[model samples]
Target: MKTLFILFFSIPLLSACSGGASKINGHPNIVYILADDMGYGDVSCFNENSQIHTTHMDRLADQGMIFTDAHSNSAVCTPTRYGVLTGRYAWRTRLKDGVLWSYDEHLIAPERMTVASLLKKKRYRTACIGKWHLGLDWEKDEEGRTLLTRPIKNGPNANGFDYFYGITASLDIPPYLYIENDRVTTVNIDTVEATSGKGFWRKGPIGDDFKHIEVLPRLTDKAVGFINTQSKQAEPFFLYFPLPAPHTPILPTNEFRGKSGTNTYGDFVLMVDDVVGQVMAALDQNGIKDNTLIIVTSDNGCSPLADYNELAEFGHDPSYIFRGHKADIFEGGHRVPFIARWPAKITAGSETDEIICLTDLMATCAAIVGVDLPDNAGEDSYNMLPVLMGEKIAHPIREATVHHSVNGSFSIRQGKWKLEFCPGSGGWSPPTPEVARQENLPPIQLYNLVEDIGETNNLTQQNQQIVENLTALMKKYISDGRSTPGSAQKNEGETPLMMD
Candidate 1:
């Protein structure tokens, strides 16, 4: 383990690192590619023992910086996406548990300030090109039946993106069709059989051209096309390429079907890596590689559907050394692989252990454009530009990062000590919520992550004082509404925190 320090003077380095005229107005083109239910160990570069090889992801990591301790704001898709774009925890909103389904109302309010909306203020061409699980408003017919004719009123287009090319929710959900900007490309009048067991997609109405296997490839083509188009423009652009693979209906294209030498999920990961290669090649062909800042990360940990038993037989532990998978409060659920490539700025092959959350992107981008965000916005985001520039920031960038599970379980982390408010996994591990309550398990659990990264030992009974301190801090963060220093705001609803 390396002892890293934060030295705050990195703004000057940003200017010095600006390579040439390729930079548009002192800012680089930003492309954020988020993977769905991809594990930290899925990428070979992140885990040496990983059986699934991701050559493109490895090369990208070698060319840039990797955050060893990076995490998504929540251990699920919709909530994490909301936190990433809005710079606030999703728990603060009305959706405290589970996720948004297709045909649900838009989660992002019309007045909410998102990363896309914020970047638009600086004249950046913004586009969201895949898996928009944050929710949308659907039109209805005279008979109260859902209608796909009219364009969605408050979707990605209304939330600040100039264009939106993606699906309304997970590929497994109903009304399977592609959405361009605000309108569905075609109406879903035909019903598709349930693809469960093979991958797990519910039976629903699907568009004529909407094939489960073709979604990833089509999205890759669109993302590459968007990059090529930007080459002709003088303004920097922001592309949020959220992939919808390795999550459900693990349908790997024919070309990538047998590539991983593992299961279908592994093959799907290889397909995702190929998409990364395509995006990188597009930047190269456009001569924008030097001026483009590429980011690759996952929304959360791997899902159980990836076939943990089969993968383990092949020497691949998707969650690496962590205990639980996707929805747990443990490391495996929230910690994800994060790699950033900026040829004009970041040193190649650099790695950092700085604790950071996905929500930090809002403030990081704000700092890149030299804009001061209002006190009301990006309240939970911290500027990690210094870390990106390989400089040590003077003050602590974050006091602590809060973790959320699919079941609305809450956990707080400050340095090495972590306090989980729930007794069991709070997700999908042994002693299910029902079982834990029946057996009369302990009320809370605590772990010093520095000593026990696996969270095998519980220190709650011994460290009552530490537990009390962290518990108080979590409460304060909730009451204050905003985590970072700013004006205190009001939570959209009361959080059902079980803390006494």
Candidate 2:
């Protein structure tokens, strides 16, 4: 790890923009809960017109700061998770587009420093308690087949987590089983097939005890249990709870099926909210609520599998005012609900429009522990600790942020001007790949988001100079191997001149 920082010395030192007082007396227990496939408007605190009743999520907002301009580093699951853990954009790696399947090799290189790894340096007991879509290194059998029983490598435990209990991929992916530490919990693995048009799960092998409907509750129970036990220890703990609900296999428990009164998807969102409430209650019961920094957010925007059309018919809009859904370059695809509550530090019920990315967690956590991060680590992360502590800053936290879609399309946002490197949605939305080419649409699209929040018009033709400036900036960022000001590090692979 020391050698990794050798090249980072040239990075400029970062200072927290100060105004408000921060009451961080000592180390606090950190609980970062991530919801899957949840849109920005899915939470009532974010969207006034949201039909889904999220009592618990709203309660969380009332107790913390809600960020109106927060986003996942990527529009899809795997990449976003990668960015969350590594604090580097996924496009910088070999995975240029799409997501990793259940059996894909580990995405995190062995040497990379993750948020868990960074916090462990501060003597915090770290645990990841839910979905880990970022690829894992599964052992091989005698015949070279994927060996599930053997101890996996380059996984959560190997990547700096002191303990881990979670699924290997999305609930819809194959080889459904529970992993505790580095090994699978169950010995039996029988092939089973289950399908749903709305839920969208691929049929594959499963553990005898694994049930899709029971996964959320089971994960929540484990999280609460971890919180309860860790609370007794003298050392502070960091729990990374990445949820696996409201994505696919939208299985809301029987008790919550009709709770939302809109659809199964809406009900599942409510169920996610309840899970948040349960964690909050656990913290309270353990007498660690005030000192615990509870952050509740989603991996990305809601997936289309949730039936947006039907949701609208029921007067509920998952994407709300944003156009397009998950996997697109639009705000609706990657912009998600972000809330942080630290009773001892952050002001309650406050809000900020501070542009931020989920990847920034690494730098923020590092700041919390008063550790200086090397340039090679968290190349794209900006320290938002001041904002988290409710400090009013004079300047923007980030100079520019990059956005990636499922199809490897790139978009860069600097202030209110955004430049997309591709035409159409750059995802699953209308103007299909073939249609985009047939219609001979412009190769790039630019938008002045300040004037057009819905992205109803393209300003590429009118602002050629701005387009050129943004394009040059994007190229420089990719070529420099980092978005932040630092000694140029090495990228895992070459980024194409055109992202495609």
**Highest-scoring model, TM-score:** 1
Model 2 residue 348 distance off true place after TM-score fit, in angstroms: 1.9
Query: With candidate 2 superimposed using the best TM-score fit, by how many Å does residue 315's alpha carbon deviate from the native?
Result: 0.9
Please report how far candidate 2 places residue 487 from its true position, in Å. Answer: 0.6
- Model 1, residue 245: distance off in Å is 1.1
Minimum summed lDDT over a 10-residue window in model 1 is located at: 1-10
lDDT of each: 0.82, 0.81
Cα misplacement distance, residue 292 of candidate 1 (Å): 2.2
RMSD of 2: 6.2
Model 2, C-alpha of 452: deviation from truth (Å): 0.5
Clashes of each: 6, 0
Regions more than 4 Å wrong, model 2: 1-25, 497-500
lDDT of 2 by residue, 1-500 (tens): 00000000001112222211122234656777888898888888999999997898788779888889988888888888888888899889999988998889899998899988988877778999988877888888789899888898888988889999999988899889999998999899998777977666887889988988899899999988987887667666778888888888889988998899888999989998888888888767766566566777788788888898899888888888998878888888888888877776778999998899988988878877788889899999999888887777999999999988888888999999989888777788776445777798887888888899888789988999999999999999998989988889777777774544
* Error at 121, model 2, angstroms: 1.3
